[model samples]
Target: MTAPDDLLRGVEATLFAATEPLRADEISRHLGGADVRPALAALTEHYAGRGIHLVERGGRWHFQTAPDLAHLLRREKEDVRRLSRAATEALAIIAYHEPVSRAEIEAIRGVQTAKGTLDVLMEAGWVRIAGRREVPGRPTIYSTTPAFLTHFGLSSRGDLPGIGELRAAGLLDPVDEAYAVLTGSGEDAADDGDEDGAGAD
Candidate 1:
């Protein structure tokens, strides 16, 4: 067994050179299968308030800029797309009820989801096709991706904000309000886009 001090240092070096976030087991494999959790905990504590802090998202460990100092490094911000109300709604649905089918999404939305809506989310790497649900036509199901966790800084789906939180954050809207107050969050009307046969695909 490597000495405690050496093990800690080795774990730090391995994570620092990693091209992407690594799982604890992956880190252990790199250290000749050494028990890496203790070292990881120590490193996590060591970097607690530093410029870069170790964080685990969706079972992967990586260092991200500390919350307080992140702005210092963002000299130029990336121009990212702001999700439409429909896209945001669909995302929340998938996050809460993952491995859900397109028909389920439409049913919950009370409107046939436009084909491009899920496409937009997939393009953003926040959603993915999880495979066909085992039934009738085997409709494609959707789920939030790990990148969704990373982008949102969530440790897991369990970390997703609750309804009250979303309402407080001003992210919740009339559609959500209607859905919550009524049936399983379904709206009262269909969309013009879907009515025009865009939902046919």
Candidate 2:
């Protein structure tokens, strides 16, 4: 008979190999239920003292490399990507409160974002249109992309750094504070002079 311990090792291997966080249902399907809990617990406990740790968030599970290893990883290559104050704010709003409309973004920002703002994010492959809102005149909604998670070295959106983390890093630039003083409604909601204006594509 296969030992529950071996079954758990299999579960742990599967979990560790996944690039994205796995839902419990998916994990359970991979490991037979009778030994699933014991396997999961054993794997979790086994990695407790290691450089990597299994983490659960937003009902999904994944392994995260330890923060202590960050500096060491940095030595492997030069980090090149750095977001500007406005870019960071726009990204944050999209990430935390996704499927948000441009109008909503303007409201939070308190001033209009330039045309290039969303374009830049999209160009970087970090943001995309989630879908159009089901309201009158249905506006297109935007949300962070999986590429955003990968670029940030996060296994999922839940791993996004909080306000406290930003403040601690001394990288918290209050882009919104300046928005309250601006006059553009915090959105570039103007018509693009398209011949088929108001037509949904």
Candidate 3:
């Protein structure tokens, strides 16, 4: 007979090692079981004292460092990608006014954004292709994902930092400041490339 504790531990280990969140069904399938919630609960309780904690959000499971321990991990705030001025402008426009098309983004920024810039954001699990706009060309529309909120520590896009926040943080340079706002650092950076979540990019 397979010990339930063993099963729980296995699930916990898998979850910890995962680069992105997983669904309970994904865990159960990996462990050859139909129901792993009990095992997951047991594991959550077992690791309740550890530095990390397992959590479920948006139907996905992830292990995050305990809240109290997070400060220890804080580095300079930064963006996942070191976006160019044009890219940053484009992203900001899309984020604030989402389900927008490339044309709209270009119109707002007054410059044509490179496809690669959007690709980079998509790869970062922040921006995602929502659907085609109902226009003559049916251009694809882009929007921020829930993961964007989670990564930015926001409950909704309405919580996105405003100009005041940027001014207060003294992150004025559009490029570096954008990264700083997103990643807590101010350097030419790149995406970690963990886009496994649903419609991640």
Among all candidates shown, the one with the greatest lDDT: 1
Candidate 3 residue lDDT tens string, 15-116 = 878878788998887877647888778777867899987766556778778878998998787634555554555666776788899888767655556677
Best by TM-score: 1
Pairs in clash, predicted candidate 1: 179-185
TM-score of each: 0.78, 0.62, 0.58
The TM-score, computed over Cα atoms with residue i paired to residue i, of candidate 2 is 0.62
A best-first ranking of the candidates according to their lDDT comes to 1, 3, 2
Candidate 2 C-alpha lDDT tens digits along 1-201: 178767777778778788777777787777664446566677778887899877665556778777677666565553254444566567768877798888887777666666567777898888998999999999989998766665555566666656676576565543442222121243342224212113212
What lDDT tens digits, residue by residue, belong to model 1 across residues 1-201? 489998898889999999888999999999899999988888889899788899989998998999898778765853466555567667778888898987898887777778888898899998999999889888999999888888778899877657787678575654464333222234533233323145445
Between prediction 2 and prediction 3, which has the larger lDDT? 3
* Of candidates 3 and 2, the better by TM-score: 2
